[model samples]
Target: MNYVLALFLPPLSILLIGRPILSIVVFLIWVPAIIFSGGLTHPMFILLAWILIYQAHQDRRAR
Candidate 1:
């Protein structure tokens, strides 16, 4: 679900994963990067979100 969400909305997915500050930073950059670059930069954010999601899951498993 979140992977799919990350594909579409990386910042929101990141926020869901519990990183408000990063979400804000990604949001700030994602918008213009999308607009100007025509989504070429989107995969970067998606990858970032996916990594964060994976990390969060790992953290839960560790705890």
Candidate 2:
């Protein structure tokens, strides 16, 4: 699942760095993740993880 993680990396990077451009890049990556992993995995877990990571990034930026 390296490819799956890799897909998330760009968006994760953007989230941590607080770059809108990178965030857009992340979305691009996420699209495939959604397509490939969506039916295979638990959607709630994926969504929760994303929200948690996003919130954590935002909190870090606010600090």
Candidate 3:
């Protein structure tokens, strides 16, 4: 679900993945990146969100 969510809302997905601080930071950068770069940088944030989501899942499994 988060993987799908990341496509459209990476920062929200990151927050859902349990990275409040990083999500705030990403939100700060993502908005401008999306605006100034004409969405060219969106995929980067999506990828970052996906990685964090995956890591969170892995951490849960480890525990």
Candidate 4:
């Protein structure tokens, strides 16, 4: 569910994964990057969010 959400809302996905600070940073960077770069940079943030989500899941599973 969050992985699928990451595909669309990267910052929100990051937040959902439990990284409030990082999510805020991503939100700040992502919106402007998308606006300025015409969405070219969005994929990078999406990938970052996905990686964060995966790591969070792994951590959860390990617990």
Give the candidate number with the greatest lDDT.
1
The full ranking of all candidates by lDDT, starting with the best, is: 1, 4, 3, 2
Candidate 1 C-alpha lDDT tens digits along 1-63? 843553349888999999999999998998888778877987788889999999999999999
Candidate 2 lDDT tens digits, 14-41? 5664556757754765676667876344
Clash pairs detected, candidate 3:
none
Single out the weakest 10-residue window by summed lDDT for candidate 1.
1-10
What does the lDDT come to for candidate 1? Answer: 0.85
Q: How accurate locally is residue 33 in candidate 2, as Cα lDDT from 0 to 100?
A: 62
Q: Candidate 1 at 52: error in angstroms?
A: 0.1
TM-score for candidate 2, residues paired by index: 0.36
Predicted candidate 4 versus true structure: per-residue lDDT over 1-63, tens digit per residue: 853443349888888989999989988887777667777887799789889989998998999
Can you give the TM-score per candidate against the true fold? 0.85, 0.36, 0.84, 0.82
RMSD of each: 4.4, 8.7, 4.6, 4.9
In angstroms, give how far residue 57 of model 4 lies from its true place: 1.0
Per-residue CA lDDT of model 3 for 3-48, tens digit only, reads 3443349878888988899988998888777667777987788789
> Which residue window of length 10 is worst by lDDT in model 3?
2-11
